[model samples]
Target: MDLNQIRNDFPTLQEEVNGKRLAYFDSGASALKPRVVMDRLAQFYEKEYSNVHRGVHYLSQVSTLAFEDVRGKVQTFLNAAREDEIIFTAGTTESINLIAYSYVLPYLGKSDAILISEMEHHSNIVPWQLIAKMNGMDIKVVPVLDNGALDMQAFDNLLTPDVKFVSITHVSNTLGTVNPVKEIIEKAHANGSKVLVDGAQAAPHMTVDMQELGCDFYVFSAHKVFGPTGVGVLYGKFEVLDQVKPWQGGGDMIETVSFEGTTFNVLPHRLEAGTPNIAGVIGFGEALDYLAKIDVNWRYQHELNLLDYAMKGLKEFPQVRVLGTVPGKAAVICFVIDGVHAHDVGSLMDMNGVSVRVGHHCTEPLMKRFKVPATARASISFYNNKEDIDQWLSVFPKIFKFFG
Candidate 1:
């Protein structure tokens, strides 16, 4: 693969920081948008902008069609069964909250429990806790091994009939560990429980087929996949979604309204309320198209190659302590120096013209599990090449000197 050609597609790659080219490595937080995605957003706003499904003008008709077309694009992207099963939300955080508030919580009772892993982002953990607290349900945590892999034996012990729902991250944002979600789903189904796979970290790196995985629900964010923010996807099986109660009320999601009674709209519309993020969703569609044409297998190999080089180079330093050394992982790496706060490390790296994420990464519990205050992280993507990793590593040994 011509890595330079791929880098050129992103206009941001041309930018210089601190007199050097910007080596962005914070893709786990949010991916840098491609030129196509940004152009699509501008095109929609300039020519085809309108509030969807609420008007009968030229722009509205065009906008509504384009808006709903995105749902179909997303449906095809994830290999979901039908477009009606896809609902657009703010992002992964809202997607999980929707499941907790609208889908799972209604069916759960006092005797029920929700199962989540130790490596989950706060989005997955907090919503379930909120619903569990309100419904008198218990939350069961699956611990992680020293190497940051899930303790599946403990998971087996925790899986019982009482576990009405199992929500776990498909990839850890902090650890880059790709979990055995398909196995988790099958096991949960065997025990008569529904499963929701958080795909925020997984969607950008690999293929996500809802039908093949057999998870009842799946969620991912657009910004993390080279699309715009304020938009994401929540996919549910139609049969299961038919049982969920509506959480929000407005415009297109209502079938009929009365002074005494009201009826909700069908499948996805019932779940989506208010004026939608029309332009963001439209750009998200093009982002999916961008991903479909690329040789993702090559991208995966390239990323893994960069990761291996980064890991090998990082291990040579005495002060650097790597976190999450699972056998199979994504290109992401998290570590901290001996006496530096993660934020300070990140600042020094910034001065060296490399951008990375630092601190707890919204996984305070995972930080607690590892007994660290925080860690500096370099979250890689296909756009990042070996030079980006080398740029990061070049600054690591000098972090203390730069700070001094």
Candidate 2:
């Protein structure tokens, strides 16, 4: 990918912040939207703004086609089996919640357990907690090593026959460690468990295929992948989704309603209730289309080169300890400056027009394991370059001196 040409696509990258050009290192939080996505959203609202599936009006027909087309786009994006295997929700949190309640809750019992890892975000962890609380099912945790990789030995030991489901984060949002998901899925399947991968981080950085991974279910959020917020995806096998009941009941999700009883809709629509995010879904399609134009591996290598620069530069300062150094790791780098609050570091970086994330990064258990309360993170993205990394790295000396 041409980094210079691609960089020009983002309007936010041109803005000045605090007397300096903006160096956005916070793509892990949410990616900056490109102009094409903005134009698509405006076109939808300006011309074809109407509710979907319920109206026979001309505007509604146009809007419904555009909205449903996104479902196909996502199916192709993830290489899911069929278009109906894709379900839309608010975000990654809701996607996992839908699986927890609809597919998982009903299958759990006192003798059954759900397996997760120490490095999971709150979204992946808390939903299983709710199911465990509701039923008597147990929540088993796979440990993370000192280097921030999942302990495969511990994971192997934890995968007992009682584990009815396994949900794991595909990549550590904080550590950027890419787990061996294919092996994990196979191991879980060997134990008669269905696997759900939290691909919110992996899908954005690298190409993902749900079929080849052999995962029964996979999910990610749109905003993380340069699409609009308020939309996320849940990809389940046809057989798996066939077994799951609807999580919500409302207008479009129902096939028939009576005073006696009500029947739910089919495949994805059953899980997706009420009027969906029409404009946001349309924007998501455009974002995916824009993404398809770029070579994924090229972008990944460029980001990795940026990551190497940051890692080597951080090694120069003895006070700054970077976290999660592993081969085949993604661009996110979490680290801490000794004796300095992460928030202070983040605030100082912001003053230089350098954006970064601070704190436990929604993975408090991982933080507790690492024996730190919080850390400052400079997460790189495809739109970011070495200059952006240098902008943040140059401020580190000032941070250290100020803290001292």
Candidate 3:
């Protein structure tokens, strides 16, 4: 891959911050958008803007075709079996909530339970908790090992017959631990439970095939994948998703409306209610096309090299305590300086124009597991290089000097 060309695609990366070159290290929160995606969004708004599936005008038909085509692109991207199985939501959080309310709450009884890991984001945990509270269902947690890997033995123990559904993150947003989701899916299916994989982190870094993984449901946000925010994709196995009732009622999701009776639409439209994020979805398609041009192996190796370089540099600081040391983990490092708060470290980094995330990162449970209140996370994207790492690390000595 041409590294310079790839970096050039992101206009924000070229700009300066506080008189220093911007070194973005917070990709785990949201990826920097490529110029192609930004231009596509502006183009759609200027030329092709219209409400899809409603009007008979020329712009409406053009917009409808463009919107539906994105659905097909997502289907091919995830290797889903059918095009109608893809549903667009606000983001991964909304997708999980849809499943929790529309599928799980109705299907599972009081005696049933759901299994999730301790490393899950609040988005994955809170929805199930809401449903479980209303229905008296149980929520079981799989522990995280000290090395930031899931405890497979505990997971096995937790995967009981009573566990009717399993929700797990493909990659931990905090620890950057890539879980054994395929194996977990196989085990869950063997125990007669359906599984949902939160692919928000995994989708941006690596390729995901729903058929190969054999997951019942998979979800990821567009912003995390270099697309626009306020748009996300939820891929469900057709057989499983067809059984779910619509969670919200509105214009597009309905087949017919009357005072006495109403009927819902089929597959995708049944789930997508009201006017959707038309411009965001179109830009998301452009982002996917942008990624398709690059060789996956090259991108993967590039980020791995960056991760290794950053880790080696962090090792030089005795006061630095890095969390999630799992081998073969993704390109994220969550660490804490012994004598400094994470917020202070992050603020100091910002003065040097090096952006990083500092906090629980929506995984308070994982933070407590590591015995820290918060951490500074440097999540690497393929766009990043050794120079970004060097600039990020340069702030640590300033942090020490200021704190001491």
- The true-versus-predicted C-alpha distance at residue 393 of model 2, in Å, is 0.9
Stretches of candidate 1 exceeding 4 Å from the true structure? 400-404
- Alpha-carbon lDDT of model 2: 0.91
Model 1 global lDDT (CA atoms, 0 to 1):
0.91
Error of 1 at 241 (Å): 1.3
lDDT of 1 by residue, 50-161 (tens): 8998788999999999999989999988899999999999999999999899888898989999899999999999998888878999999999988989999999999988
lDDT of 3 by residue, 1-404 (tens): 88989999999999998999999999999999999999998889999989899789999999999999999999988999999999999999999999999999999989999999999999999999999998889999999999999999999999999999999999999888999999999999999999999999999989899999999999999999999999999999999999988889998999999999999999899999999999899999999999989977788889999999998988889999989999989998999999799999888999999999999999999999889999999999999999999999898888899998
- How many steric clashes does model 1 contain? 0
**Compared with the true structure, what per-residue lDDT tens digits does model 2 show for residues 147-197?**
888999999999998998999999999999999999999989988999999
Query: Which pairs of residues have clashing backbones in candidate 3?
Result: none
Q: Judge candidate 1 at residue 299 and give its lDDT.
A: 78
lDDT of each: 0.91, 0.91, 0.94
Cα deviation of 156, candidate 3, in Å: 0.5
Which pairs of residues collide in candidate 1? none
